[model samples]
Target: MPVRREHRTRTATRTNCISAINGTAVGAGDHAAIVWPLLCGVAKAKYYLMTADFIGGREAERIGLVSLCAPRARVLGRVLEVAAQLARGSQTAISGTKKSLSNWMRMAGPIFDNSLVLEMLGFLGPDAREGIGAMRAKRAPEFPSAKLPGAAQ
Candidate 1:
């Protein structure tokens, strides 16, 4: 099935202060293609996105994917502390800074839109079905797109 046109809209911008504890991070959909590059650099983004590797908290912070990594037990407390500090800051200054930085992402709107279209199209192809089947069967995906013409199975 094709993705609905209305569902292809760009994600809304918001102030994100990511903090990770014990869990890992993986970019879903447009996240790897767009958001990851905006947060980290292209090299790091591509490495992680392409591999679909699980990123630990420390690795995530080192790559600039997260603002901080807190001990699992202290995660909630750390989050509240950061929230409190932000709440004390001047809203006008914070809002303006966010808008300025967000313009960088806005500049990539065309690229993001094109990538999104391609990604959605992939969902309608044979590889998508094979991928899902492989996952359900607990086996590595033998993507249809990876098959070469006249190659024996």
Candidate 2:
């Protein structure tokens, strides 16, 4: 009973936290990360996005993160070409298709909202304090792995 209660409490806390962030659209990309796990079984999406971990264009394309990579010098021309192609297509059909995709993508909104709240909660904790202090002190942040009060066990 205690374990069940703890789980419920933790879930409620998470939901509330996410709700707060969702209200502001601060975690919109989180929905994509959360859904990526469902569609592509990519569990590291959130971690990669949050940590600003960068992959090269080729690697991103290989992983299906991008359709193609353009050389730096040709990027503008490539983009313009794509835009012109899109503009030449049926605008109404393209708009409707985009809306459909957007609606499907929005299924992750709740999860993203929760993640944002958790992130905001982290900002109010010791780790955030230490991080800010380290930044002000001109040192690297030494984030502790210890669990805080509302953190999941």
Among all candidates shown, the one with the greatest TM-score? 1
71 in model 1: Cα distance from truth in Å? 1.2
Q: Write the per-residue lDDT of candidate 1 for residues 12-100, one digit (tens) a residue.
A: 34464545355554455434576788778999988887767788888878988878888889888988898888889998897688777
Residue 45 error, candidate 1, Å:
1.3
Residue range with the least summed lDDT across 10 consecutive positions in model 1? 1-10
TM-score of every model versus the real structure = 0.79, 0.59
Choose the strongest candidate by lDDT: 1
Which stretches of model 2 miss by more than 4 angstroms?
Answer: 1-41, 44-52, 133-139, 146-153
Tens-place lDDT per residue, model 2, 57-92, is: 666556665455677676667767777777787877
What lDDT score is found at residue 43 in candidate 1? 93
> Pairs clashing in candidate 2?
18-113, 18-114
lDDT of 2 at 87: 78
